[model samples]
Target: MPAINAIAADKLVRLLGTPRSPAMIDIRNDAEFDAEPRLIPGAVRRAFTSIPDWAPDFGDASVIVVCNDGGAAGHGAAAWLRQAGADADVLDGGVIGWVGSGHPLLDTAAVPPRDAAGRTLWVTRARPKVDRIACPWLIRRFVDPHAMFLFVPAPEVAGVAARMGATPFDIEDAAVRWTHDGELCTFDVMVEGFGLGAVDGLARLAAIVRGADTGRPNLVPEAAGLLAISLGLSRMYPDDLEQLDAGIAVYDALYRWCRDATDETHDWTSHKPAKSRVRA
Candidate 1:
């Protein structure tokens, strides 16, 4: 049986990128982390020695601490968090266990340098319709929960990225690594690049995003509806961030549908079932 304070590696995997996922803290030592520089999706790295300084930031929120092998580092950090009044747990097998379980670990190398406050900053073309919003949604949900974005004119994307230390995406440039690859849109590349290709729902959503963003709504049945909604949203909020705040909820719903309700259908006939069946 699993310990009351420990969450199994596989069990944690299912909640890795969801909105209700517990705060994930990676407490691997410097040497261990140097050997493996990746991080589990949505996990933030923190020092075990600095737990006291950071633990308070958790503020009674549930946290799951991970280490290289689920040994002293993870358990110790989780314990410290619990002592601070947070509902904290350790990952049973840690990062190694997650890798051994065949779950994807994000390649930290692809992530841009975080700001002083520890948030990945990115720049892209302004007036986003589909790819821009989808990419940020993916980042906030899976890569960095506190990521920031800057929207600028199309011609200014690269210049802003250079001056502001932001990673540029979805633009025409040989150096921009996050742009489209052949038929795949930026969202698809990110999903694949961040090691989330194996996630069935994200892959499905990526296809729809790709289809909608690239002007090929016929590629997926959901693409047309997504495009229509995205267009409407673009008109609703001229301010990019305001649009994004509203757009997040849209993607959140679409992702849930992709993950949990893909086969579900609703029609007037179902609600108007025969009286005998309705009673039962």
Candidate 2:
């Protein structure tokens, strides 16, 4: 059995895609990572030697520390994080346990460059309705939990991205790598690109996003409703970032519904019993 102080990989997997997910820190050494360069989904790499330098940065947030096999590295980091006044835990078996459980891992090589603060910066068209919001939601939740977005005029997306060093996305340009790919929408591309396809619910949500964003509502039954809600949200908020902040909750609900509540139905009398079995 694993140590009681650590959480199982399965439990952490379910938490990874949600807002309540703890800050995940992978503290594997260079030689260990050279043998396996993948990262647990939604996890960021931190040098074990620099724990003192970075531990204070996450003083207010809970953290999960991971190493090769739940040895001295993760233990030391968790201790440092706790010493810094943050709630922290170690992975039960570290990356080995995570991979052994068949959980998803992301290819770190495919991830875009991060800014000074370790956030992936992105630019997209302003006045987002569906694709733009959904793509950011996907990126923030699954790809880079600390992703940054800048909304600009459609004509200036590429220019702003070049000048500001942000990756341009959800806009049409042959040079851009994050746009729609033929039949798939930006959300679909993002989900696939970030190696999140293992989650069947997210894949279904991607279809809905594609249909909603691409004017192909017939492809998914929920597409029209999503589009309607997205447009309404856009109208409600004048600030693009405010709209995105709201959209994050929207997609969060949608993702949970897709993941856990799709087959569920509700009625006022769900708790009420039938009329004594028809008085038989």
Candidate 3:
């Protein structure tokens, strides 16, 4: 069994793609990290020695500290974070344990450079309907929880990205690596690029997103519903950021459905009385 302040790898996996997941902090030393540049999904690299400066930044939020082997570094960082009043825990086996459990690791190379505040910034075309919103949702849930996005005029996306130090995505620019490839939408590219294709439900979700964004809703039964909802959301919110904020919840629900509820079905008769069922 794991220690009281340590969470098992399998248990942590359940929380990874959810909004309630704790802030994941990777405190592996330079040499250890150089050996394996990937990170647990949604994890950010932090220096264990610098906990004094950053621990308070978490405030009362929950945190999970990860190290090379779930040894002194992780436990020590968690202890320091607790002292600073943040609720923190160590991963039971750290990166080693996480890998041993056959969980997926995010390819750190695919992520764009972060700003000084450690948030990945992205720029995209304004008035988003599908892929634009879906990409941000994927990035926040699986890559960088604190990522920021800039929505600009389609013509200005590239210039804004260059000037503002943000990565441009989902546009027609050939230079943009995050755009669609053939029939795949930007969401599909990101899932594959970030090494998240193996993540359960994401591939299915990507298909839905692709079908919705590319006017190919016939690709999946759920794609038509996603497109309808995405268009409705775009009409409801004129402000791009507000629309994105709302769309995030939509993707969250869709992801959960794809992951856990795909095998289940519901109808008016699901909760009907036994007498009504017998009569039917």
Each prediction's Cα RMSD?
2.4, 2.0, 1.6
Per-residue alpha-carbon lDDT of candidate 3 for residues 31-51, written as tens digits (9 for 90 to 100) = 999988999999999898888
Of the candidates shown, which would achieve the greatest TM-score relative to the real structure? 3
Candidate 3 residue spans exceeding 4 A from truth: 271-280
lDDT of 2 by residue, 59-151 (tens): 868899989998777888898899899898899899988888888888787789999999999999999999899988887887789899999
Better candidate by lDDT, 1 or 2 = 1
**Predictions in order: lDDT:** 0.88, 0.87, 0.93
Q: Indicate the worst ten consecutive residues by lDDT in candidate 3.
A: 271-280
Candidate 1 per-residue C-alpha lDDT over 177-229 given as tens digits, one digit per residue, 9 for 90 to 100: 89998888999999988877776489899989999999999999999999999
Count of backbone collisions within predicted model 2: 0
* Candidate 2 structure, TM-score to reference: 0.95
TM per candidate: 0.92, 0.95, 0.96
Order candidates by lDDT, high to low. 3, 1, 2
